[model samples]
Target: MKTFSAKAEEVEHDWYVVDAEGKALGRLASEIAFRLRGKHKPEYTPHVDTGDYIVVVNAEKIGVTGNKEKDKMYHRHTGYIGSLKSVPLGKLRETHPERIIETAVKGMLPKNTLGRNMYKKMKVFVGPEHTHQAQQPKTLDI
Candidate 1:
């Protein structure tokens, strides 16, 4: 018996649409990361970009438990000294809802070039409307 390893050129990427309304942040992100990494496929190859494209909608309605809404802080630093900046999850939702899911899923992916390529396959929208209708993505229930 021989082990099967999928190749990048031989892999077929499928498009899937997910509704984020009322879904838990962490759980949803993990699921999205799973699909993005192509783990759901039988021919998954870790070294290859075998993930499928994911379209996430209703990002503004994603849910979080406990005090995460206010207590969970996202931090960033500027190039200049003393330029650290932070924002609460609640505030970030109001300003950039799409980033909420994006950040969560990003953290779950591999921290390398392969991960960045997989991350690019995900598309997030604040509302139900997305521009990927042309691809006829199937609805993915998480």
Candidate 2:
């Protein structure tokens, strides 16, 4: 029997809704990344984008286990020297809660073009409301 390899055109993408309220950030991000990479599906193919769309809500309520809120720092660099900037997780949550989840999930995915394509399938929102209602996404419990 020939080994199965999923094709992009043959893959079916489903939309799933995840509630981030009161959930651990790392665990939630891992699950979301798993689905986004299509690892949960039997037809997963490494070269093809076989992931599903994930819509995450209530990002502001996501929990951290330890002092990550204060000690965990997000760093960025401007083009020039000595232009590095950092922000604590706590501040990021207050300013851009969605980014906390996005950053976590992004780190878990492959560092390639395929990974970037899969990452685009996710949508994160700060509150309980999302605009993907038209997709009729089913609730996905992590």
Candidate 3:
């Protein structure tokens, strides 16, 4: 038995849809991270990028437990002598709902090129409507 490695191949990929409405942010991100890393597939290869596409809908409705929405902060710097910026989770959700989920899942993934590739497969939308209807994505029960 050979273990699967993280490599890019020309195999067919499936598309899955997840509704983020009323779902916990961390829980949803874990499931998406699993699928994105191809852990749910029978032919899962640690060194191969065999993940499927994930569409997250209603991102604005995703919830965070406790007071994270207010206390949680995302920070970034502009590469300057004292250029630091931080945004609260609650504000980010209102301004950019998709980013909340994206950030959570991205953080849970491996920090490497393979992880970046997997991150690209995740598509998050603020509302229930999305432009990926042509792919015929199946609803994921997460």
Each candidate: how many clashes? Answer: 0, 0, 9
Give the Cα error of residue 54 in candidate 2, in Å: 0.3
TM-score of 3: 0.93
Candidate 1: which pairs clash?
A: none
Per-candidate Cα lDDT values, in order, are 0.96, 0.95, 0.90
Ten residues in sequence with the least summed lDDT for candidate 3: 3-12
Per-residue C-alpha lDDT of model 2 across residues 1-142, encoded as one tens digit per residue? 9999998899999999999999998899999999999999999898999999999999999999878989999999998999999999999988998999999999999999999999999999989999999999999988
lDDT, model 2, position 137: 100
- RMSD for each model, in Å, please? 0.6, 0.7, 1.7
Angstrom error of the Cα, residue 140, model 2: value is: 0.3
Q: What is the C-alpha lDDT profile of model 1 across 1-142, one tens digit per residue? A: 9999987899999999999999999999999999999999999998998989999999999999999999999998988999999999999999999998999999999999999999999999989999999999999989
Tens-digit per-residue lDDT, 1-142, candidate 3: 8654544655457999999999998888998999998888877877788889999999999988899989999998999989999999999988998989989999999999989989999999989999999999999999
In model 2, the Cα lDDT at residue 62 comes to 98
Better of 2 and 3 by TM-score: 2
User: Which regions of candidate 2 deviate over 4 angstroms?
Assistant: none
**What ranges in model 3 sit over 4 Å off?**
1-7
Candidates sorted by lDDT, best first: 1, 2, 3
TM-score of each: 0.98, 0.98, 0.93
User: Model 2 lDDT vs. the true structure?
Assistant: 0.95
Output the better candidate (1/3) by TM-score: 1
